[model samples]
Target: MKKRDILFFSAAFVLALLFGCGNGSSQHSFALGDSTFMLDNKPYQIISGEIHYPRVPREAWRARMKMAKAMGLNTIGTYVFWNLHEPEKGKFDFSGNNDIAAFVKIAKEEGLWVILRPSPYVCAEWEFGGYPYWLQNEKGLEVRSREEKYLSEYKKYINEVGKQLAPLQVNHGGNIIMVQVENEYGSYGADKVYLEMNRKMFVDAGFDGLLYTCDPEKDIVKGHLAGLMPAINGQDNPAKVKQAVRNLNEGKGPFFIAEWYPAWFDWWGTPHHKVPASQYTGKLDTVLQAGISINMYMFHGGSTRGFMNGANFRDTIPFEPQISSYDYDAPLDEAGNATDKFMKFRAVIARHLPKGEKLPDVPAAKPSMALNAITFDKEIGIFDYVGPGKVNENPLTFEDMNQAYGYMIYQTKVTGGAKTELKINGLRDYGIVFIDGVRKGILDRRLGQESMMLKVPAGTHSLEIFVENMGRINFGPNLLKNKKGIVGEVTFGGKVLKSWTMFSLPFDKVETSKIKETKSAKQTPVLKLASFEVAKPLDTYLDFRKWGKGVVWVNGHNLGKYWSIGPQQTVYLPAEWLKKGKNEIVILELNKPEINQLSSLEQPILDQMSDNK
Candidate 1:
C-alpha cells in the first residue's frame, strides 16, 4: 500500500474510535416502521411495566423497578401526574416523591428502558384525574380542549416536563425510547385536531423520540395519527390485536400492547376485586408466543395517599369517590410484594427468552406490623371549641373556608319560635344537623333534598351542621368547579339563619400529631389513638366494621377511609410503613363511642363485615 494511503487509514480509524464506532457497533436510534420496535434498524422487544411515581414512595422506587426487572420486564412505563408535580398552576415540585427525573436515571443505571407518559390530564382515577383543582377555577377554562386558556396552561406543563425529560431520550444516549401523546383521547372525543396539537407540542418542546398514541383497539381509528404508531391497550388476543393494528394502519409496522390489564383497581365501600392468576398467565403466554411486545397496565399499583383518589359518577345518581389504595391486583401489590400472578408471569416470560437470557431474582417483600389501640378521654364540644369571636356571617363554602381538601364544620343560631318544619335549602352533600346537643336530622346530597322536621324549644338555640366533602365528581359535565359545603341557601322553617362559625379540618401531619384530648365542656368526642408492638411486621387492616365512617392514619400514612356502610372491608397497610418495635394508629370516626374500638383481622374488612352484618 502507498505511504499516504496507510496514514489516511490510520487517521480514519482514530476518528471512528473517538465517535464511538471503532468496534463496528454503532449508537442506536429509536424509529417506527422497524421490526420489533427497532432502534437503529435492529430488532427489539419491550417488556414494560407501568408504575406511577406519585403513587409509590421515593425510597421504594428502586426496589419497585428491581421487582419489575425481576418479572422479566426490560422497560418501565410511568404517568407523570401533572397535579402532583404542579399542585398549584405556577408552583412546581421536583423534589421528594415528585423527583421523576431521578427515577428515570435510576432506571437507566439498572439497565432498563423507559417510556414517558406525561399527561397534563392523566385519568388514572387520581384526584381530578391528575389535573390540578386550581385549573378548574380558571374562568371558562375547558379541559382536554382547543380552548385558549386550557391550551396555554397545557403548554406550560408540557414545556416544564419536556425540559426535564428531553435529554433522556434514546437519541440522547438515555433509555427513554418513546413518548405517548394525550392518553386515550378518542374514547372521550374524536377531536383529531386536539390530538395533533398535543403531538406537535411534544415535538416543539424538543422531544425528538418516536411519539405514539395508546388507546383500546376500537378507538384507535379515531385516536391514532396518520404518521405515528398506534399501540393497542387491554387486548389479550394476539392475532386479533395484530389484525386490528394492521387494519388501522395498513400493516406498516410492529404491533405493541401498551396497556394489558393484569388486574383492576378498587374503590372504597366496594368488594376487593381479584383476577385469577391462571387467566393472566394464559393470556400473556399467548401474546408472547406470537412474538408480540407488551406492557402491563401496572406492574405495581401504589397508594393514592391523602385526598388524591378520583371518583366515578356512572351508575348511581351522584358521584362516588375512589379509595386511596390503588392496589390494582397487578403482579406487584401496593406494598411492592410479588403476588401469585407475578411468579406465573415471570415463568412465562422466562420460557420465551432467547438462549442465555435469564431474569433476576425477585426481592423479598417488606415487613409490616400490627399496632395496639391507644385510648383517650373526650372533653371539648365541637362548637364551643372554636376560638373566641372568629365566626363568619354566612356558612362558608369549602373553598371560601380555605379548606381546598377535606371536611368542614358550620355552626349557626336559630332564633325563631319552636318550628316543626325545618329546611336546609341548598345542602351540597351529606350533612348532619344537631340542635342544642341532640341529633336533629340527616341531609344527603344523593337524594338532592335537605329538609328535616325538628322539635325545637323556642328562642336562641345552637344549630350545628357538619358536612363532609365526598370525592369530587371525576367524569362528565359536572366535573367543572366541584365546590364542597353548602353551595346555595340554608333556611330553617320559613326564615333563614345567619352569623355562622366555620371550622376547617384539612388534616395535616403536624395537626394530626398535636391532636389534643377533647375538652369535657364540649360535646363532640376527640379522635382516639392506640399503639401496640408486634413480634414481626404483618400486613393488616384496622377493621372499621364496628365503627362509623372516617379516616385512618397508621405511622402518619393515610390508609384511606372505612365506613360502617356495606362495601369495602379492608384498607391496605403496606409493611414498609410499620416499625417492628412500635407503631402508632389513629382513627377519626365520624360518629363515635358505640363503635369506637378497632380490631386487626386476617381477612379483608369488606368480607368480614359482610359475614358479621
Candidate 2:
C-alpha cells in the first residue's frame, strides 16, 4: 500500500511541474532591470536601429532587418507613421509597405527584437510629422495635446496599431520588448495627462512590454513617467546623460539614448549639413565607454521618395520646406551606401565590445552610374495648351484650381496704361512674374511679401506668372493651411486686372507625357531634346547643379523639386526604381533657356557646384 501511494504521489508532482513551467504567463511579461530583459526574470540588452515602416519599402523590410542584424544590432526600432497608416479618418492600411505586422513577424524570423514607437505624431522630419493632413482640416485641432478631438482620433490609431502588434510583444512569444509613448512630447508640450493617456491606451490594448519615453535630457523630467523607464534622444553629452536619469528618476535603473544623431538632413535652398566623421565616432565611443546604450538616429536614412519630407517654421517665415531626399548625411547615405562615418562608428563599437566579441562584416556597397547628356525642349508655354474650359476672371489658388500638388501658370493680357507700381495681391509662397519677355518682379513667402512693381509696356501686353507649391507646412500655428500659386488679385497702377487665363500643371506623369507642341508668341524660344543610355539600372543622381532650377523625372517617376539653390544640389534616385537599357530622363528648367543640355553624375546632385556661385 505504501509503494502504490508513493508512485501516485510522484506522478502528480511531475504533472504539476510540466503544466506550471509551460503556462502562457511564462512566455509573456518582460522584466527590465533583470539581466536578459527577463520574461519571468532573465538578462537582456536591446541593441536596436531606428527604421520607419513608411520610409522603407515593404519589399526591402527583410533585407533592411538583415542589414540591422549584420551591424550587430539585435533589435529593430520602428516608428509607426500615422499619416501613412491612416491617411483618411477611420481608414487604415496594414498591407504592402504599411503592413507593420508583417514587418514585425519578419523581424522575428530574422532573429531580432522590436521596439515599437507608434507615435500618432512622429517628428522624424516626416510630412506633418506623421499626423494625417485631415487632422489639420479639422477646425482648431490641437496636436500632441489633451484636446478631446485629438485624443479621440489618437486613441483610435493606437487601438488599430495595437491590434496588429500587441499579440507579437515579447510577452506573447514575439520579440517586441518595449512600446514607446508619444515621441519627444516634452519638447513640444508638457501634457503629462496626454502622455499617460497614450501609455494607458497601449496597456489597455494589451501591450504589456516595458513602457518608456524618449526626449532630450532637459525634457526627461517633464516627459517621463515615474513608473516607466526614461530613454534620452539626441543627447551625446555624458553629464547630460547622467542628468537625464537623475532628472527623470533621481538616478534610474535603465537609461538609453534613443536617438544619437550621426548626421543632419538637407533642406532646399540651404547648405548641406555634414558632420565630421571624427565627431560622430568620438561621441559614440564616449557613450559606450560609460556603459550607456544608444541607437543611431538613423543607422540608414533612406530616400523620402515622392512628396513626403516635412517642413518647419522659421520665425516670421511661413514654412521652411525640407527636400524630398532625406539622406540625413547619415552613417548610411540615402542610396544605402556606407559612408566614412559608418566605418569610423563600426571601428569604435568593435573596440568597446567584450573581449573576443567581433562586430559583423560590413555589407558590400551597391553600384551606381552616371548618365550621358539628356535634353528637354519647352516647345510652348504651359498656358497655350488650355482647352475648351472657360477662363476664370481672376486667378485661383492651387486648391481652388483642383490641383493638389505641383506648379501652375497664370497669364493675362494688360489693356490698361503702364504703371511702375504693380502688386500681386495674394501670392502664397513664391512667384516669378514676367511682363512681356522681361522679368518684372519676384514674390517670396518667407518675407510675407505678396507683390512686386515692374516697368510695364502700356496697352495689350503679356503678363505671365509662374507659381510653385512649396512643400506644405508640417508644424506650428498654420499647419491646417494649404498655400499654392497666386491667392489674390494682380494690381497695376492701383487698379486690379481681370480675366486671367490659368494653366494647371500638377505634372502627373501621364499628363506630362501627353503634352503636345503648340505655337504662341509667348512660347519659349528654345526647344531642346536630350537623351541618355544606361547599360543597367543603378541608383543615379541627376546633378541639378548644372541647371539653374527645375523639376526632373526618371522613367516617369518624379525625382521631386530641384533648385540651383546653394544647399540641396543632389536629388536621390533609387536603384529599385531605375530600369535597364535606355531610361528616359526629363527636366523642366525654370529660369534657364539656352543652357538646355543635361547630364547625370556618379555623385549626388546636391554635390554638384552651387548654381548661385
Candidate 3:
C-alpha cells in the first residue's frame, strides 16, 4: 500500500473507536432534532454523494450506487428531471432510466440512504432546467413564480412524482430520509409565497420525511423555510458553513452542506473544469471533523446523453451552452470509473466512517475496446426530406408551433430587390441562411449575428433559413426568454417577410432508415451513414473530432450532439447500446465535416481543444 493508504487506515482505526458502527438498530426513524437529525432517536450524520438516474445508463445504477458505498458514503442524492419524465405534458414515463422508484430501491439494495429532488424546476445543467418544454405552450405559465398556470402544472407534476417516489421515503419503510423543496429559490426570487407553495406541494404530494432547502450562503435565510433545515451550497469553509447554517436554523441543530463542490461542470467552449483533491480535502477534513453532514454535488457524473444538455446565457455572457458530456471531473468520472481523486477522497471518507466500519474495496473499472475506423461515404441530403409545413404570416417559435426540440426550417419567397440587409428579429441559437438553394452565409446566435447583407438578381427566389435549437438557457433570470427557433419576424430591405412555411424537424421523428442512401451529398445538410461489424461489443467512445457539428445515432440510439468547438472531442458509446453483429451509425452532419469517417476510442479524449475554437 502507498504511504497515503497506510495513514488513512491508521486514522480510520482511531475514528472507529470514537464514532460507533452504522445507524445502530435497523428500525428506521428519521426526524429533525434541535440541532441534529435523529435516526431512531439517535443523532445521525448523512454522508452522501450525488448521482442522477437519467444521466447514468439504467444498466449501471446499481454499480454506481455500490461504488458510492465503497467511497465511504452511506447515502445517495439524486434529482428527478421533470422534462424527462413528462416529455409531452400529459404523457409520463417512469419506466427505464426514468424509473425513480426502481432507482431508489436499488440504492436501498446497495445499503444506501436516498435524497430525492423531484421537481417542477431542478436547474440542473439540463434542458429548460427540468421544466417540460410543453409547459411554455400553456398560456400565462410563469415558472419559479406564483403564476396560476405554472403552479397548476407544477402541482400536477410533483404529485405524479410523489406517486412514484413518495412511498419510498424512510417513514414509509424505505431508505429515503430527506426530500428537498424547490431547488434554489433564493437566487431566483424572494417570493416567500412561492417558496411556501413549493413546501406545501411536496408535503401534499406525500414526501413526509425531513424537507430541506438549499441555496448559496447569501440566499440561505431568504431561500429556506421556517420549519425546514436550511442547507448551504458552494461554501466549504467550515466556519462559514456553520455560521450560515446557524443563521438559518436560528442557531439550532442539523447543519448540512447540501452541495459540496469537489469539481465543476464543463461548458461547450470552456476548458474541462477540474478541482485538485488537495485543494478541497483540508476543508473537507475540517467539516467532517466538526461532525457536519455533507453531500458531494456529484460523486458520479454520467454522460448528459441526448440533446437534453443545457446552455447558459445572459445580457453579458451571450451564449455558452454545455457539452453533451456531464463528466463534472468528479470522483467517479463520466465512464463511471474511479479516479485518483476518488481514492484520495475515499481515504478521507474512510477516516470519518462509523466505528468498526470499513469502506468496501473499490469496484474495478469496466472493460473498453478500440475499434477500427468507420467510413460513412453513403449519404442522404436533409433538404431532400423537408416534410409538409405550417404556413403563417410570420415564422412561429418552436413552442408556438407545438414542437419542442431539434431543427426548424423557415422558408419564404423573397421578391427580387437591390442589395439589401436581411435581418431576423429573433434568430435563436444558430441558423444556416440559404437563398435559391445555395448556401449564402450562416446566422449564429453565439456570434450575436442577426443580420447579413443580401444581394439578389431580378427574379422571385426562395429564402430559407435552417435554424437549430442549440439548447435552452438552464440558469439565471434569462430562462424565461429561452424559446427555440425564430421568435419574431424576418425582414428584407426594411420590409417584413410574409407567408412563411415552417417545418419542425425534431430528427428523432424523422425516418432516417426509410431515406435511401445517395451517391452525392447536397449543398444543404447531409445525413451520413456508417454500417460496421463487431465480433464482440464493449464500451467505447465514438470519436467526433473530425465531424463539424451534428447529432449521432448508433444503432437507433441518439448519442446526442457534438460541436467542433473544443473541450469535448468524443461521445461515450456504452456496450449496452451496441450489438454483436452489424451495427448502424447515423449522423446528421449540419456543416460538412472534412472527414466522413468515425472511430471508436479505448479512452475518452474529453479535454482536447478544437483548433477552430
Highest lDDT model number? 3
Give the TM-score of each candidate: 0.85, 0.82, 0.94
- Per TM-score, what order, best first? 3, 1, 2
> For each candidate, C-alpha RMSD in Å?
5.5, 6.6, 7.8
Model 1 C-alpha lDDT per residue in residues 437-516, reported as the tens digit of each score: 67666776655557888778878898878787766666555666576787767787777778888877666542444445
Q: Ten residues in a row with the worst lDDT in model 2?
A: 18-27
lDDT of 2 by residue, 1-613 (tens): 6999999999978865533231222245667562124445544445567777666656667767766666667777888888778867888988877888988878877767778888777777777677765675456677777788888888888889989999888766777888888888777777677778888987887877788888877666777776778889888887777666766665554557888888787776667788889877777778777667677778777766555667777676556777767777777777767788777776777776667977667777778887776655434444443443327888877666655566777888775464567688767566777777555656767567776656665667888787876666665555555546777788877778888877777665524443445323442422223346667877777676666666666777667767776476767776776766766666655666446566666777453335362
Count of steric clashes across candidates, in order: 18, 16, 4
Local distance difference test, per candidate?
A: 0.74, 0.70, 0.84
| Candidate 3 TM-score to native | 0.94
Model 3 per-residue lDDT tens digits across residues 1-613: 9999999999978765432223322358899877678888898888899999988888888889888988889898999898888889789899987898999887876788898887567888898898888888887788898899988888988889999988878787777899999888888888888888888999999987889899998887778888888899998787888888887777876778999989888887767887788987788888888888999988898888767888888676688788888888899988889988889888888888889988889989988998889987577776776778999987899998878789989999988768878999988888998888778888888778999998887789999899999889888898788898999888899899999999888876447664576555357877787788888988899888877888888888788788778688888988878899999888888887335778878998888777552
RMSD of 3: 7.8
Candidate 3 clashes between residue pairs 3 or more apart in a chain or in different chains? 34-253, 35-253, 35-254, 36-254
